[model samples]
Each structure stands twice: as structure tokens, then as C-alpha cells.
Target: MNQATRNVLCMTGIKKSFSGVPALWGVDFELRPGEIHALVGENGAGKSTLIKIMTGAYRRDSGVIEYDQKSVAFLNPTEAQAAGIVAVYQEIQLVDFRTVAENIFLGREPHRFGIIDRRVMNTRAADILERLGLQIDPRSVVGSLNIAHRQMVAIARAISFGARVLILDEPTSSLTETEVSVLFNVMRRLKSEGTSIVYVSHRFEELYAVCDRVTVLRDGRNIVTRSLSTLNRLELVCYMLGRQPEEVSKGVTAFREQSQNILDRPVLLQAEALKYKKRLDGVSIEMRHGEIVGLAGLLGSGRSETVRALFGAEPLESGTVKLEGSLLSLRDPHDAIAAGIAFLSEDRKADGIIPELSVRENLTLAALPNLTQWGIVSRKQQNELVERFMRRLDIKAASAEQKIHELSGGNQQKVLLARWLCKNTKLLLLDEPTRGIDVGAKREIQQLIAELAEQGLGVVMISSEVEELVEGSQRVIVLRDGQSIAELSGEQKNIKTILHAMAEGADRQEAVGK
Candidate 1:
């Protein structure tokens, strides 16, 4: 059969915009029956916009969407789903408090005589999960399940809709290697059954392993589409980055060069055998005065937990935290802050910022005590501090009174950074600092991190991006199953070494369990 005949989904001349800015311009995409097509791009490459258009979450300004050999315009996600098109995003959409079976058949439960049929729904949900090779109980609450299981439930729910075209956007970002393999197997089975799958991820290895064809998008336009067998890793990266492989390598090396001289700095902070319930087990780490230490691991590998324990967000069961060789007690964030420690949480919107507050308010929230006189804030002193930080951080805000929510993601992050800097923090704990921001902002933030380290601030960074971890840190601590498994330093801090350490740690843990 010809390609046109086998195409299950075809998008042509797709044009979409937001508030006069074009996100996708004349982008064309196609998915063949029974084939796993990969949609690859850097952040803001219009990948999500195009996917939203396809799934009817967004109305395209102009486009032709052909599905199942028929031109169709879906009015909403429900319409798209009814037409056999389903999308499973990175963030699971299921309700955590609800049972798996209830979530699966939510809003469309089996009914008899105006009453819900729980048994029928549970049986069907269990069957769907079993078919996907997931052993989770249908009656189990989603909140009690692990991230991997939650991902499986999302996929199972998609399948339950009798979807012919499945769109997975970063489905395995939080999953372990074993869970990824299981997801790949499920995708293969769906492909064999003539379902078209659109797999979107930044991980090249995953795309190469499961996808038959690759489509690269850049600047809201389609760059090229090629078969996986014909394109090598370097070629794929070059296409996505629009730069030569040598240039990319040089960029990485340049970032690495900044951290080469910080190895001999005096120890600034140390955690000895930190224990925090079941999340952290004797996790010990040390940071020097002018060094950045990266924590590398999978989603449930205790990277976030380690930082939380160190920052006193989560109470440590047993541990000794020392600052400059003196043992200290960090009973809460206030104590940590008093000791010149600052933490920028991973969820910026949820934990880092108060959206309704102005930039000045959010920036000065932490350092209010210092800026206050008696029981009231000294406006004169507060103005001086906010202005200094705004200028120092180059935060792009209309004025100090501008709402933080009105600023771009990058600027909001800069405000958060300035909050800690205002307090004269000696150590900064940055968790996924560059996430959800654009490329230019990411580069600026990374450069700022390096500059801060040069100024003698100890930084403990945690990022899901391996490139950031490799380029920004002088040392990386690999964690697995709540334990500090390995530490990579100097020349060992490369991506290959970190991945190898993680894999080895997983193997050793498996052996011990056996």
C-alpha cells in the first residue's frame, strides 16, 4: 500500500497563534497505521501546540486535519476521543483520590436502572490493566499508587476509550528503566494491533528504540521527517538543534570549563547519614564553598527527598547537619534560612511563588524580618532592597508593583533567585530551576548559577535534564532507592558516567533484594 493510503492521521498547513504570536506556522505532520511516530523538538518548538490542535484542546487558526481517511474538525477533547483519538500527557489527568476503576470509567460509568454498576466497571478496568501488563488493583486509590503505576493507569484509560491513535507526551519521564521497558512493550503490542502511536520525548534513546519514524519541529514549524533506520543520533540532534554536532559539544565543554577550578574550595555544608523516614536512608553529602553539586536519579530515586531533608522541609529522623564544620540543628525552614541556607523548590508555581503577589512582595517575602522595623515594614529600606535585586538579577518587570504572575516564566524564576540572594544565602538548593522556561532563559539561569558559584556560594542542583547536570556541576551524587549509591567528580561527571552509575546502582539494589 502507498503511504497516503496507510496514513491514519494527517495534519497539513497547520497554523495556530496566541495573542497575535504564531506558535505553529504551516506545520505538516502525518502518522501511519500501526507505526510509532516520534515528535521531537526542544522546548517551545510548537510540539505541544500542534498536539493540542490535533487533540482538539486548541482550535487551530487554519489547518486541515484528516483522520481515518476523513477530514474532521473536532470541537473538543470529548469529540476527539469519540472519534478514536486520545492523548496521554506527561501529567496524569486522573483524580488521585478516586479508585482506579472509578477513574477509568469516570463520567461514563456502567449503569443499570439509574444506578452505577461498580462491579462491571471494576471488572472492565481490571481487564484493561491486565491487558496492558499492569498488575495494579482496580479498586486501589490512584494517590496510593507509584508514579509508574499512575502512568500505566493513564495509558490503560486511553486504551479503554478504544483509541486508534494514541499520543504520548513524555510518558516515561518519571519512570524507571524497567517501567520504560514495560511501556515500550505495551506500545509495541498496540502498534501490532494496527493502532497509530505518536511518541513525544526529549530522550533520543527512547525514540530510537520504539519509534519507526521521526519528525523534528523547530520554531513552530516542521523541520524534517525521516525513518529512524536512516538517521544516526548526531544527525537527529543536528536537525533538532539546527547546529553542527561539533558546535553543541563545544557549548557543553564551555559550560564544563566554568566548574573545573572549584574542586578544592573549603567545605561549606555537610550532611552526615541523613535519614528521613523511608524516603532517605543514610544519605550523606558534602558541598564546598564555591562548588555546585548535582543530585542525579530517576523520579522516585530520592533526589527531591534528599534536598527536602537537608533543607528541613521534611524532618530528618536521624542526621547531623554541619555548617563550616560546626554541627547545627535545622528544625524547620526558618532555621535553615537563619543558617544562610536557601531552597528553590521544583514546583515553582505551587511552592516557589505567590502568584497574586507583586514582584516586590514575593521577592521580599523571605527577607521581610530584616526589612521590617518593630512590627511594621520600613518602606524606604524595602524599596532599596527590591530595586537592588531587580537591577542585579535583570528581572524584566514593568515595575516592582507588577504582579509576579504577569511576568514570563524566566523572570519569575529570576525573582525567586533574587529572593534567596537578598538574604545573603551561603548555600542555594535549586531543584529543576530551568524547567518550563525557554532556551534563552535557561541559558541565562545556568550562567547565573555559574556566576553565583564563582562568588563563593555553595549550590546543590537537581535537574531532570542530564545535560544541565553534566555541564553545571563539578560533582554529581547518584541516588537510588533512598540511598546514596555513587558520587561522580572531576572527569567522571559526564552524562555517560552518571547514567552508568545509576544503572549500576539499580543492578546492585536488585541483587540485594534478590
Candidate 2:
């Protein structure tokens, strides 16, 4: 391929800002035809912003975008789609209640005599799926399909729009090994057909398996772009983290050296052989007072399921839970709460907050019964408690009456934490507590977690960020395929050790299956 003909898309000196805060600082990116280019970075490394600008979800402050040898600036996603740029996000965006065909041809379906043409739409959808080597029923309801199939449908929809540049963001996060294999096959087919793909994922193995080249971004700037053949995993991780291998090793050593003195503390919560259908398999966990235990695992590794079962959010098929050496029967979350357990879900927007409620209301939600008397709430008590936590947790709000939605992500999370604290819970369960927040907010939350642990509240934290898990928790339990594989403490509680345990767990499982 000639130099000019090989370049399918080129973006130069792209700059974007949100409320005077720079997200992308004069970054450059390019994609060659028929190659899968991986875009990778930490949560706030500006990958999302750059992708949005490329897909026309956001307008760039200043940049030059050349596509197919022609300079073009698309004002919206529709325009970008028309120009053959499309994206399929991690969260599948399709009408679950509708048929797969209807979802694929939505908004621009074939029509005859001013009426929708179902036959034509189904035929087209079936053809696209077949071309993609997906054997899904186009006439079937989208909701009836598994997560992998739903993802395939989304890809089919994007291809139907004539996408030349396809962006796949964390597409295999929730898929099984078999499903990921199928997706990889589809990606290989797309690449062979000369479709330039932009693949974004946190899984290093997946990227190495499928991508030809990768562009690493750090602190909103282009750090490096190199072919996978030339770049080692350690070098890529160092570039993304802005850390040297020696520095990372030293940090891990320091963390292990400064171990906390919580070994003498009595057990606060104990779960024995917790089982929940296919999600959890004989999971047992023990937490001591004034101790922070970290749960580490990839998606579908039973990390979240273990916590849900402990908090009684999901019915436990077997096993027993004990608090302070006494058997505790938890039929539901209310019982768990009554037994002094609080769970903060990973999805903060969906389960953590009531957007329309005031800050005071959300903060005092769980402790409402305690704040009430004679079937009437004591407004004075509620206000006093809310004010205390708001100040203590450093929740920023104009007033306690301010709507929870008006605050930033960090403040919203603080409100949720306050809600649980007001109940005087003995054990706290936090899942992805620092996700989707800025660096400053993440630090504040980490500090708060430390403070809570010091105050003798046992904490079970589940985080996808390996660094956070290593630094925040004295003990780390590694889970794999619905089973707890290894428990690391002190010297064993480092990133390298934890990752080795996870990989070994996967290898053992594969061997057993074979």
C-alpha cells in the first residue's frame, strides 16, 4: 500500500476542553486501513474524549481530521455515521423489547407505500448477520439474546451503516471465554475485509491477541504509538502509568513493609461456603474489625456476586453467615442492614443515588426509621446527622436541600456513604468505589476509606483497578470463574503476585475443563 492510500483516518493536533478543563491537549492519532488499532489509557486519560471527538459525539476545540484523503469535520454523530465512522460501546444501545431486525434498521427502515417493510428489514438484517458470521435469529427479540449476541447485533447495526472505521469499546468485558473467541473471529473477518478498527479495552491479553498496533495516552496527551510486535507488555504498562518498572516494584515493597497492625482484631463478619446458583461457588470470606479486605477479579469472576450474597441482595443457595461469632440469618437486604451491613453497588447512578432527592434525603435514606418516631420523621435529628456527615465526608453542596443530581460524582458518592454511615453499620461493602471520577475525587475517596478502616469499620472493597486494590487493602482475595482462588497478604499483596494468582487460576480452570 502506498503512503497516502494506506492511511484511512488521520487526526492531528486535536484539542478539546470541558468547562475550561482540557481533556485532550493537542493529541494526534491515526488509523491505517484494514488494521486494528488499540486505544488504551487509565480511566481519566482522555481516551473517551478523543473517541467522542473522532465519532463526532463532541466538537473538537481545534484539530485537523483527514478521512479517505479528504479533510472533514462532522458536527454530530449522525454526520459521522454518514461519513462511515461508527462506534459500538460497552453498554449495548438497542431496543430490548423489539426484534433484532427492527433494532438494526431502526429510524431508517425500508418502507413501501408509506408503510414500514418488515420483510425487507428482516432480510437485510439476516444478510448482515450472516456476513459477520453471526448465527442470530433476526426476528428474535433483542432482550432474549445473551450479552454476547446483543453485542453482535450492535456490530451488525454499525456495519449496516457502512462503517469504515469501527470503534469497539470494552466489548468483551462481560463475555465468556467462548464468546470472546467468537468476537475475535468476527474482528479478524472485519480486518481481512479492509475495515479499520479502533479497539479499546483494559484487557491486555485481548489487545495483544487482536490488535496490530496500539496508541497509548496518558494525562490527555499522546504518549506513544507502536506496533504490537515491537512493544512488550511491561513497556506498554509503564507508558500508560508514567512509571518505571523499578519504581513500581519499590512502591509495592513499601506497601508491604508498612503493614497495619490489625491481626489481633476479632472477626467482624464471616461468610462460609456462600453459594448462589452459577454466580458463586463455595465462596467463603472473613473480615476483621478495623481491616480492609480487597476483592480482585476480572468481569464474571464472582467478585460482585460474593458481595451481593453476603449483603443478602441475592438469595444464597447454601452457606451460613456469622457476625461476632453468632449465626446471622439474612432473608433480604433489610435483614442485612438490621445486622449492620451496608452495600454500595458498583453502578452508582442506578443503585446508589436518587437523583431527584435532596442531599439530606439521600444521606438519611437508610437511617430513615431511626430518624423517625410515632410514624413521623424528626426533621431536627435528620438535619443534624446530614450536616455532620456532609461536613465530615467533605460533601460539596450549596445546602442540604440541594438536589443530589446537582453535585459532582464524588459528592454524590459521599452522600451515599453518609446514608450508610448514619445507620452505624459495622461492615461496609464497596464495589468500584472510585470509578468514573476524577483524580482528585479518587484520592479523597481513598483517604476516606482509610479513615473508615481506622475507626474500626470492617471494609470489603472490590475494585477493577489493580493499583488501588494493592494500595488500599492489607489483604486481597483473588477470584476466578465463580471461585476464590488465592488470598494474598503482606508480601504477597502486590500487583505482580495478584495478577499471577489470577492467571494461574484461569490456567488451572482451563486444564480441568480440558
Candidate 2 ranges beyond 4 A from true positions: 1-4, 94-103, 107-127, 136-147, 232-245, 248-265, 272-284, 296-322, 325-335, 343-365, 379-419, 431-455, 462-472, 479-485, 499-514
**Where does candidate 1 clash, by residue pair?**
none
Could you tell me every candidate's TM-score relative to the true structure?
0.69, 0.75
lDDT of candidate 1 vs native? 0.85
Q: Estimate, for each residue in 1-514, the C-alpha lDDT of model 2 and write its tens digit.
A: 6645778999999999999989999999999999999999865689999999989999999989999999989999999999999999988999999999999988999999999999999999999999999999999999999999999999999999999999999898778889999999999999999999999986777878999999999879999999988987657766775655245543331123223778788889889898886678888899899888999875566899888888889999999999888898888998999998999999888999999999999999998998889999999999999889999999999999999999999889888998999987999999999887777788788889888888899999998667778888888998876788888887667776665555456444334233
Candidates in order have lDDT scores of 0.85, 0.86
Q: Mind sharing the TM-score for model 1?
A: 0.69
TM-score of 2: 0.75
The lDDT, on a scale of 0 to 1, for candidate 2 is 0.86
Q: Name the weakest run of 10 consecutive residues (lDDT summed) in model 1.
A: 245-254
**lDDT, model 1, position 181:** 94
How much is 457 displaced in model 1, in angstroms?
1.7
